[model samples]
Target chain A: MKSPLSLEPLFHVGPAGITEPVVVSWAVIALLGLGSTLATRRLSVIPSKGQTLLELVVSTVDSQIRETMQADPAPFRALIGSIFLFTLVSNWSSLIPGIEPATAHIETDAAMALIVFVATIAWGVRTRGLRGYLATYAEPTWVMIPLNIVEQFTRTFSLIVRLFGNVMSGVFIIGIILTLAGLLVPIPLMALDLLTGAVQAYIFAVLATVFIGAAVGERHKPVAPSEKEP
Target chain B: MRIDWWTLGLQTINVLILVAILARFLFRPVIAIMDERRAAAAKMLGDAEAERAKAIAAREAAEAESGKIAASRDAVLREAAEAASAEREAALATAREEADQVRASAETEMRWARAAEESAASDRSARLAIDVARKLVARLPDSARVDGFIDGLARALASLPEASRDGFGAGERARLIAPRPLTAAELQAAHDAFARALGRPVDFAVVVEPAVIAGLEIETPHAVVRNSFRQDLKRIVEELTRHDGVHR
Candidate 1:
């Protein structure tokens, strides 16, 4: 017997044929690119309408970096600001008709996590030199080196799983709700989808900022009283 | 659930292409614009601080200038007061000097007026004495013999009196004929002048009085005569006039 929540497609294409999800992902990317380009082109002293909207988004991301990094935003500005906007748009793409959230798939989520993980490692090594960055794992002594290395792999795995699980859960719930009640019943769940989209985007951006901050050590250190002392 | 490897492969390729294009074109340019905006905010904050400092400096300079102007004004006022006081003192000194000169000239004029009045009084006394003498002689006789005898009598009346007389009797008459209250030097000079005429030692006392004003008198145990009556009357009248002038 077929489960009520089964999502198996009704039709099939020939070998190397495209699916609806792939086609929708491609269209979402194109839309995001067009919107971003129109918003960015022909910059002004006092921004044009589209430019103003883009500046608002970029400035919001920049402020978050300044708050988290708390140091010169020069180094982490490019990576963190890009990740924030990209994740936000990608997560929101599922709201359009005939499209699915690509982040709900493990492969897509892993790709994004890998970008952050590689950047984190690169920045850590660059800031403290390779020897120093690797030595951070040793922590107390040489005896803990193996455990520290295992911890690094676990951390990377968790990053990929966390985003994947959350987004997949939202899709699964929406599908289950739609199948049970048919059309209008999915409206409340759709509202929840919008919230979930924005929350996921925020979590991904903040986590990236925190990871970069950790790489630079005292860069994102708490705004302690001693900071204002000197 | 079952795995679908082929579907996953195609989806992976599609996702990769989408991410790559979006990252390159969309996110990259947005971040660039953000950086430009951040730099502009920092510059504006710095400019505001600089303007605040400049405004404070300008205010301080204005205060200093006003303070200097006030000090100069005070100094000018002080100098003006001092100049005014000096001018007042000079004027006062000139006024005092002129007043002193006027007072001195008034004192000199009063002295001259007093001397002229004294001379006029003395001339009147002399003229009255001469007139009285002429009247006395005319009552006696106008003949040459009688005129010559009266002239001789008048001469005899001017002679010195005896020294033993006292009071208004014989002694008073003698005092009226002789000088009283005389110093030893004046007595010595008088004796030296009259000793040759009398051919004897002479001693007398002289006193200043209005009783015998301008003429001499003689009195002795043997004889007595007076020629000082009219001169004494004239002196009395003049003194009475001076007293009346003071009262008036």
Candidate 2:
């Protein structure tokens, strides 16, 4: 008979049974906050090189807001930009020797996806006033309300699965390649891990913007011709 | 591997609390600072734009002031020129009036002096003539001949240029004849002037200036008439003297 692989406790938990991924996720968040704070310490009207890079990231998030929301985007500026930065760093955690990527686990991905889903619902209700937001589902036919309700749940599911699958796949592939090669031959696969980490972060942010945009439903059309007609 | 629901549920709750606390404490303050910075930048830009507008307005005002000063300067120059011309005209008028007064006084003095000298010379000549005449009357054959010669000499002295013509008998007279028609206005003015002088209108033929100059003479018929080039020349010369001071 073959022996099963013995799984030992990776690390100690606190009184509340906090696991490795939770601590690593917090660490990743702290690192991202520290990096962003240091980059923008001396905020200049004319940006220095480092601040320019930070500004480029912020403006990219702002542009995504402007495109997907089709409005001034003042509201989503901090929310989406912080999410992108945090996710990007956390997805890169496994590259370090002692730290595993929190996003590789379904629980971490679910927390991130839930943040996006709740934010999307809150913005939709805030912009469209609850009754109008619910009426969006009755479009094309009043009978399709149940299907529309399922769609909202499916969107949250898809967000969680997509992030979890991509991060988990990259980690598993790199682990398998290392086990087989056992040496420097696994370098290319680790390189791919870095690439996948960045790509996954971008995909999560983009999909979040799209889903939020769909829930918000066109945001009253910035400049409506009908309002000007009278 | 068996699923551990207790571990998963506890981890999810822990993560939610941590995220909420982090977002509230760290991210919120940082975002607020960023928004404040953005507002300050926009305010600075607005202030710069306002200052630029004020500067442009000031420049335009300066240019307008310059234009007004230039226009005022031109107006002052024009007024000065008008004042100068008025002064020159006034000076010329005063000079002309002074000259006319000097000429009138000079003429009056010469006339008085000439009258006194002529009276003295005439008295001496009359005395001499009287003595000579008395002697000649004594030597002559009849007193009537001496008296008649004295009368003839007196008439000659009175009409030195045309004494014989003046002595013509009442039966003899000169008349005028012309060859062309005259304008109605000229005829009417002449007739009106004559009627005013005579207290009654008279009929007369009107003639053109060319016909009178070419065909008429001074002694033509019942009255000695002067309607020819000689008369026209005299009238033109008299008019030129009045207008141009040639004879004055």
> Best candidate, TM-score-wise?
1
Candidates 1 onward: DockQ, in order: 0.17, 0.07
Clash pairs detected, candidate 1: B165-B171, B166-B171, B179-B205, B179-B206, B180-B205, B180-B206, B180-B207, B181-B206, B182-B206
Writing each residue's lDDT as its tens digit, candidate 2 over B1-248 gives 33233334544554555455435544454445567778888898899888899989999999999999999989998898888888878888888788777877778667656654554455445445544544554455432322223223223223424443343222443222332343454346444543453344434543334323322332313334443433444455445434433222
Question: lDDT values of the candidates?
Answer: 0.61, 0.61
Residue-pair clashes per candidate: 9, 5
Interface RMSD of each: 3.8, 4.7
Model 2 stretches astray by more than 4 angstroms = A1-16, A36-47, A71-79, A121-135, A182-188, A218-230, B1-34, B95-248
Q: Give a tens-digit lDDT track for model 1, residues B199-225.
A: 443343343443443334444445444
Report the C-alpha lDDT of model 1 over A1-230, residue by residue, as the tens digit.
98422235434666654544445555666776677666666775566777777767766776787787776665665566555555566666666654667676665556666667777788888878898788777778989999978866676667767776777788778877777887888778778877887887788778877776776666345565676868
TM-score of each: 0.64, 0.60
lDDT of 1 at B107: 68
Worst 10 residues of 2 chain A by lDDT: A1-10
Q: How do the residues A92-134 of candidate 2 rate in per-residue lDDT, one tens digit apiece?
A: 8777875667777776667767777788888888879899788
